[model samples]
Target: MNVLIITAHPEADSFNSYLAAKAARVFEKQGSVVNSVNLYSENFEPVEGKIFYPDRQDSVRFDALREQRHHWEKKILPDDVSRHIQLLINSDLLLLHFPFWWFGMPAILKGWMDRVFVYGGIYDSRQRHENGVMKGKRALLSVTAGAPENACGYNGRHGDMRLMLWSPIHALHYIGYSMLEPYLIHGVRGGLDGIAKKEQQKLLDEKVEDFENRLTNIHEWPIIPFNREDDFNEDKTLKPEAPEYSPFVRHDPDGWKKS
Candidate 1:
């Protein structure tokens, strides 16, 4: 299995980076070829603008959709974006490592998706969801949060962590990945002084071992569920007979009205 591990963190020696590095080691132990992308270390750009497109279709106005398609067709994407896309095309599994920021992934990783998951090359109207060009691929997310595990759960202050992850869940699913249940570590506090530092280091070591175990049993990891093409109606609403995998995918046009 070819795996691509992408880590979005600024600190080179951070616990988040340690997790990412441990993940690579775990996969390597299983004889898998691993590729890693460090967003911060590599200085990956997350913004979209006309700067990347010098001779775009319209110089004045920048339409991401039109331009993405145009650039993809012309094979004129930016150097980094093109390289990233090439990596994605060659990999079978994507392992994302990041700390939960603002209830979601860091902006740098989000930018990686925006720039690398280009409209025309990565996805298009006809090449998305169950029929996405990236079908037959797998993706797993390992996230760390500041609150306790329960605090990020169903009735916690941070809300349902699964629901909170819908942003990336849907995004990856939409792009045709067999999403795995994310691995989350909570109660992650900063430690830079005295006994707190020692305790944090201990916790970090334990977490890395947990990640190793997760990777060791990776084949047994459950893939997150999603509806297939048949699960939706012609109007693109969930079929009444289909299972509602997501709370947001209910068969209720009026449910929004009630909310």
Candidate 2:
């Protein structure tokens, strides 16, 4: 099996980085070819520039701002986005590793998806009825969060961690990946100092082992079933839940008093 691991951590000594390295080792031991892309180390340009447009041939004449807008609209061509597409096409399993920042992925990782997982590679307007290019692939996410499991609940300070993963789950499912249950390490900041460091490492090692075992027995795991109905609930045409408000709320006492 060919596995591609994309790591989005800036610090070399970060726990996320350590987890990524351990996961890589396991894949190698399982006789799988592993290709790792360190986004920060490679200085991957997350912003889509004019270079991503087929129509904008001259780099000298390309407008960076215009290209940025075009990328947001998903209008770039396949050849322009070939490098990242080729990486996805060559791998059977794709593993994403990142630290949960403010209950979401780091900006760089989000940008990677914005640019690399483009229209032709991961989605296509023409193939609305059929699975896109990445169908039949497998994907797993490994994430580390500073908050404890209890805190990441509806009644707690931080909301459910699983809700933050909707983007990846829906995107991969739309493109036809057999999604594996995400392996999340909560309370990553819990054992940062003193004797807890050893315990933290041990716990991380165990999680890595589990990740490897799952990959080794990929075939045995039940594949994610494809159901168009599940994608969109019939009863609820619109998700009624209020849009998540950021924790950084601007207090306005006068406004509230008037109300």
Counting clashing residue pairs in each candidate, in order, gives 0, 0
Q: What is the lDDT of residue 177 in candidate 2?
A: 71
For all candidates in order, the CA lDDT equals: 0.86, 0.70
Looking at model 2, the pairs that clash are none
Worst 10 residues of 1 by lDDT: 250-259
Q: TM-score, each model?
A: 0.93, 0.73
Among all windows of 10 consecutive residues in model 2, the one with the lowest summed lDDT is 242-251
